[model samples]
Target: MNVATDFPLREYNTFGMDVTCARFVQIDSADEIPKMADLFDTPHYILGGGSNTLFTDYYNGTILHPAFGGIEMASQSTPTSEGTSSSSVLLRVAAGEPWENLTNYCREHSLYGLENLTGIPGLVGSAPVQNIGAYGVEVKDCIEKVEGYYTDTMQPFCLTSDDCHFGYRDSIFKHELKGRCFITHVWFRLSPQPRFTLTYKALAQALEGREPTLDSVAETVLAIRNSKLPDITQIGCAGSFFKNPVVDQAQHAALLNRFPDLVAYPTGDGMMKLAAGQLIEKAGWKGRREGDAGIYPKQALVIVNYGNAKPEEICNVYRQVIADVKDLFQVTLTPEVNII
Candidate 1:
């Protein structure tokens, strides 16, 4: 266990808010988990790649960062109870592995299922927590199991896909199991057969004439994301600050009548997912800035720090955007990024 005091967190979080943690502990491997009993007694923050986190204030507790890293084929083709070959491979990825790195690896190996999730930032451990999705694909669809250690008992546990209770932008890690465990690794099932999901219009249009393969699909997704989201290296921002709100059919109908161009996607259920960005843009907050914080003009869903913006300034901008959207559309917008 490597420990540091008054650790600078500006570099740890993608938003680039300058903040400090009281204490920061870096666990290099699962073997170090047993020695961290003292940390469990107090409230702590588990940090991954920090891509989806916004630090509204300095954290006063311990920050636990898992640095364990490895990736290997955990299982090969196996027969199921029905005597049919599964035709899938299980991969064990360490919690600290960059999410994009894993996607690139799968593409290079001709693996399917993760191609659409390329360009998403963060670690494998954080993926299940957010149930990260893009281009018509969610990580939950490929997750087989999540391995972690319970903070209270310091005991290791494994939860299968069904056990995760994954929902849109959510999982057990973000709800019932939140803050109770430290995820060490995750298992994903990938297919050998060529499978492509090109339902998203932008992606389909990008690959109009080209044959869709794992590489082509992944590249297109990355390109689409890059065209919209600001590069974190150049501009400090968290991608998609707000989640697309899901409303009942009646509310959807009323809103659609009011705003003819209201962008929405039917949930195939009674609910309709309204585009949060469209609401913000319509509310006239797109490209607007307060202090040093501003919404990315290209994508209204993103909030960026122009320079040395304080956490409160960024948060103020967020609040104003939320208020404007709510007042204009009578719809509530919730943040997808974790605000700390």
Candidate 2:
């Protein structure tokens, strides 16, 4: 365990918020987990990649960050004498491994299932917690199991994919296990052969002329993502600041009557999911900036920090966006990022 006092978090989070926590504890190994029981009695948060996290203020409590890293083949059919893989592979990825690394690993090893998730930034541990998804494929579909420990008991635990109770951008980690569970490793089952999921229109269209292989799919997904989202390395912003608002059939009908061009898709159960970016753009907020905070011009769903924006400035802009969107569409916009 490594501990730092008043640790700066500007580099830790994607938004690059300049905030500090009273204590920052880095767990480099599983042995340290058993010794962390007492620390949980105080105010604390288990932070992973911090890519999906936005700290609104300087934290007065401890922040535990998992730093251990590794990727091992938990199970897989032996490669044939000719060196051709015969079946799916299982990978046990450490919680701290970059999500991008895992996707790249799949592409390099000719593994399928994670190619579409190529450009998403975050630690592997945060994947299931956020149920991170892109281009019609969700992480939950590949996750075989999650291994972790209870903060209170410091006892080891494991959960199957179904036990995670995954929903649209939601998981048991966000509710039942939030603050209590500390993920150590995630087990994923991926096909050795390509099993493409190009149901997403844009992804399919982009690869129409090209072969739908692991390398091509990975490259295409990253290219499409870069076209819409700003590079976090240059700009400070959490990707997709708001979730697509899901409305009932009646609400969808009402909106469509007024705005015939509205983008809406049935989400079953008589509900429709509207494109949040479209909503924000239609409301004339795209490329709009207040001080250093603004909605990304390329993707209205993202709220950005141009340079040295304070937390309140970012908050104010997003709040205003929510209010304006609500007034215009009567639908409340909910943040997809974790605002702490």
Candidate 3:
């Protein structure tokens, strides 16, 4: 592990915010983590691909980047390790592995669970932190377990799926026990025979009367996302900056009177999932730019950093948009991207 001071983070995050880390260390192997941990006295933030994080200002503490990378196949057995005639597979990936790379590997290997999350950018470890999702699939659906080093105990342990408590772009890692665990690796169970899911409208439309193949689903999702979202290489953006707000049936009905054509999904528990994009667009925020920050014209949910914008400017637009949506529709929108 090599420690450096004042590291430039312009290219580290997809959002393209120019923030500097006071102390930066890259750990490429699990064996190196303990020594690195011993060197840092202050609290640290673990960064993977940096796709999901928003740096509002320069980090004050050490920034630990888990650069470890590898994948292994482990025997997939129940928690009890009972033997079975049918065999499942476990994909063990290092924390720093690019999420897209893992998805591609799964596709190439005929693994079934990650087809719907084709275009999402980030690292594998960060996926569980947010329970990252798209096109009717979420990371929690396939994650068998997460292995990490607990800062408090200074020991490594595995967390079962239920332990993660994944819920709508959130998990135990993000709340209740934030920054307590340094995830070193993750394991997932995938199917050789795919069980395809096409619940999202845009994905369904893209497929449009075709049989759902793994490649087809992935291709369609990629195409759909590429058409709307700005390329991270060109402009900085964390896809779908805010999550769709979930409201009770009564609130949905009340909002329906104001905007009858608003798109919504029934949660089956008497709550409705209203599209934040539609709300933002209706409020006239789409494609609107102030300095280097702007809302993507095609995707109201995506806030873009057009050029050399400060992180605070990006957040200002985010705050303004959320506030407007709340004032107009009486629903509070929560950001999907992690803000630091």
* Model 1 lDDT per residue over 1-340, tens place: 7999999998888889899999999889988887788888897999998889998887999998888888899988956799777688899999989898899889888789999999988889999998999989999999999998998899989999999999999888888888899899999999988888888889999899988998889878888888999999878998999999999989888998999988888888878999999999999989998878999999999999988999999989999888888898898899999888
TM-score for every candidate vs. truth?
Answer: 0.97, 0.96, 0.94
Highest TM-score scorer: 1
- Over the stretch 8-91, how does candidate 3's per-residue lDDT look in tens digits? 888788898888989888887877765555644576888888888899999988888888888887765433356444456789
Give one clash count per candidate, in the order shown.
Answer: 0, 0, 0
Residue-wise C-alpha lDDT for candidate 2, range 1-340, written one tens digit per residue: 8999999999899898999999999999967888878898899988887888889999999999999888898898766899886677899999989988898788778889988899999899999998999999999999999999988788889999999999889999999888888899999999987699999999999999877888888888989998999888888999999999999999999999999999998888789999999999988999999999999999999999998889999999999999999999999999999899
lDDT of the candidates, in the order given: 0.90, 0.91, 0.87
Global local distance difference test of model 3: 0.87
* Residue 167 of model 2, lDDT score: 89
Candidate 2 RMSD computed on C-alpha atoms after optimal superposition onto the true structure: 2.6
Clashing pairs in 2: none
**What shift in Å separates residue 23 of candidate 1 from its native position after superposition?**
0.6
Better of 1 and 2 by lDDT: 2
- Cα distance off (Å), candidate 1, residue 211: 1.7
